[model samples]
Target: MEKTFTEEQRNFKELAIEFARRELNPGSRERERRGEFSEAGWQKCAAFGIPGITMPQEYGGLGLDTMTCIATMEGLGYACRDSGLIFSLNSHIWTCESPINKFGSESQKRKYLPGLISGSLKGGHAMTEPDAGSDAFSMRCRAEKKGSHYVLNGSKTFITNAPIADLLLVFAVTDKGKGFAGVSAFIVERGFPGFSTGSALEMMGLKTCPLGEVFLQDCEVPEENRLGQEGAGAAIFNSEMEWERSCLFAAHLGAMEKILESCIAYARERRQFGKAIGKNQSVSHKIADMKVRIELSRLMLHKVAGLKGAGKRAPLESAMAKLFISESYVQIATDALQIHGAYGYSAEYEFERNLRDAIAGKIYSGTSEIQRNIIATFLGL
Candidate 1:
């Protein structure tokens, strides 16, 4: 992988690591404790061009390839301890910015992409309603056309960046008779009538990023804001999911790399019965397993990223990758906590927080079960 990277990617990765360590890591524990969103960190990341890694240069993006994006994000994960901020950044780029870039009309792209990529605007999507998580297409949100506007009604929960987002990619049922095909997506501005965000919901992890509900009660959206065609929401959603599942997990690979290193250092330095605890088979084997998981995770991430970079749809490969990497992260986090014993459980070290954050990876993007189902369907099972 090192040999395969372009010189630009290598340089970008190194710089991203340095930038994140210097700018994003400070006060992370305090932000996490307060469940505060880092506006300053967000701007710093924007100024550093983290949000525009794969966007077109014309639209204020880096115009880099998918591999470069993943490599840079992996570096971000390795150096940045603030997982919530990273999560929010990924949601902004993959769900909000990427979908608009791919499916929006030229006018819409010109209107939204620059601000989104430039970091002046924060964006997230409202797809998971209270009843429509894994079954996202079953959304109860409805958008009815009325002259020059569409009136939207329904609520979306567990929305990332909701509390602070300037724009949102909202999906709704435009024609219930057509089922999933009836779904449509719309770009909703924060100032739109009847569109409001709920108070932030506390979570076990990723607390530094705001999460909340989006309520659309007769929210009036301009016709020009509709993304793609009238019934293209399902396709738009699937595309975003593919990109997200393929790319967002790169951060996890970086994180696992960090966790592995910490575990090794602790195992080597901590004394036990005779010498370093690393000499014990139990402790040493766990650290060895961490390395194994990280390498395998890296291979899977690279494979999916390669497929995406080649302009291919990799539903099967991406599902396999998401399932493996997410589950592997949880296991790695568990082993890391175990390796540190009492210290790991304590908040003084980040192991407990890392575990909390890792658990969410399994639930988001699609649960481990959902990924298995996707892979099974691909197998014609």
Candidate 2:
């Protein structure tokens, strides 16, 4: 299906593309190598109102709908080489900010949304624990009511932006006997007593995106800090997941197109057996497949965005999009690597890095296996 974007949305995409080329493309490799999170780059994005695109204007945001946000993110991925940075930004927006915007009380929005939108305050979502990777709701973290506050005691690992986040939306058990419904969400700030970040994790890719553990020992959050009701964490988390699964990959579809272009360029220039690699059917076919995947993935993403913008539930669509695009990304990266042959295997080209980053897509934001399960359940399995 052909999708049409508004003039304002087109302008948003153009602005994001320009900003990405100027700010994110040049130093992406070096930043990844040094494991450096670019405060300067983030500030540039903030100045462009990237952090506020989907937020309300009253809260210092652009209040763009879902489609505009996806368009902007796609432009960023097309022009930017920093996948790690894009991933981190998506995590902050969908997982942290969107939840607050959707579920937080009016006072909570007033207290946190502005800084979050302006990039003055960074946010992270803490849900995964050491024992609860794919089965994320199987958490051991506990929060007990004490007076007017909830005393939290738990540890969450594999948390994105944990080391540098100013605010955290965390999930813990308020009633352990209630299984998944027992989980509750809280908004915790940095420097809260007994809240500390663990060591930074060394990841295969996305090095510039800091991942760490959050330890909450007797951390006190007032009743007002609670995101929703005591048993609303699962609902809130599922909503965020729908947003994250659908939108986080918008950038990736752009990257897939970029990779395709790069591979085609290499195939035409690099000669083998007295002819360019493009002359070979294998090389041409790989490029063809890449183009097909890019087009299909883009369509799926647009569908999800449209559904979300129309205030419709999109669990099946989100899962399908996430499953297909993530696996397609891995395949595209692999084909790009193969087209480059030995150069793709080396650090001299970005293909290797793209391959490494693609591996994580299949794992995080719900794994391919988990997505399949979700799809099956939707089919009434």
The lDDT for every candidate, in the order shown, is 0.92, 0.90
Per-residue CA lDDT of candidate 1, range 231-348, in tens? Answer: 9999998889889987889999888988988998999999988799999999999888888888888888888899888988988888888999899889989999998989999999
TM-score of each prediction:
0.98, 0.97
Q: What's the number of clashes in each of the models?
A: 0, 0
Where model 2 places Cα greater than 4 Å from the true spot, the runs are 1-3
Residue runs of model 1 more than 4 Å from their true location after superposition: 1-3
State which candidate has the highest TM-score: 1
- For candidate 1, the 10 contiguous residues with the lowest summed lDDT are 1-10
Name the 10 consecutive residues with the lowest summed lDDT in model 2: 1-10
**Model 1 error, position 13 (Å):** 1.5
**Quality of model 2 by C-alpha lDDT:** 0.90
TM-score of decoy 1: 0.98
